[model samples]
Target: MTPIGFVHSTRTDATDDAWDAEATTIHLDGDTFSPEALQGLDAFSHAVIVYWFDRVPPEKITTGARHPRGNESWPKVGIFAQRGKNRPNRIGVTTVRIVDVQNLSVTVEGLDAIDRTPVLDIKPYMLEFAPRGTVSQPQWSKELMSDYWRTIQSQ
Candidate 1:
């Protein structure tokens, strides 16, 4: 598939806690595109971003038992059971509120991507598709998500 453009953000460097990173504007870079590429984009207040965890290490992909908050004694669950950075494909998705859009740059809030992370695709969030069922997340997974949100709100 052809890439219409690329995403540009202030995150030009890597960090340990990629999920806790600050929100950055996702600007469409490179060659121009038809206005249709952005049609109806402003109707939504949020977006689903698909980006590649380009900086994740290959070896860390098998973190079987990890204390998401750095606490071990807990059960050593599978990597998929946790929100750890390492994974088979190292891809991450986040929903962020749209702040503004100017030409190629679209300002948003609540993205967890690290600086310069490679964005694969972006789609406007559909409220009808949002999760509404009960969540049965593992204890560690729940805690990890809570910690990250808390950290983001504090910043």
Candidate 2:
């Protein structure tokens, strides 16, 4: 599928963690999209971004899982069991706070993707769409995510 837009951020390369602190502006393709396409999006506090890992090489894609980040402490599970970027599909998703939506661009915070990342779609984050019951996961997964969404601390 073609990208509806692309991300503009300070990050030009993907990093392992601590990317949540930066803000990114998603520039919709003017030739295909207009301001009206993002008219009501600003009202939402958060949005779900479905983006592509265009920079990841096909050879690096993982179908089976080793320890998350190669940390042996975490149990090896199927590739689907983890949220790493090296998945077979090379797709990424993140929930980001909407800073502003103006004209054909929307500025958001917390998207982990790098600059120029193709955005396949964007959806408002609604409470009704959230999981209804408690979410459970392995203890190792919890530790793995402790800093996954953390802000970068300035020295």
Best-matching candidate per TM-score: 2
lDDT of each: 0.67, 0.90
For residues 72-92, could you state the per-residue lDDT of candidate 1 as single tens digits?
Answer: 856777767765567777877
Off by over 4 Å in 1: 1-7, 10-23, 32-35, 63-65, 150-155
lDDT per residue, candidate 2, 1-155, as tens digits?
99999999988878877778777999999999889999999889999999999999999999986888899877988889999999888999999899999999999988999999999999999999888999899999889878877877741
TM-scores of the models, in the order given: 0.77, 0.95
TM-score of model 2 vs. true structure: 0.95
lDDT score for residue 113 of model 2: 93
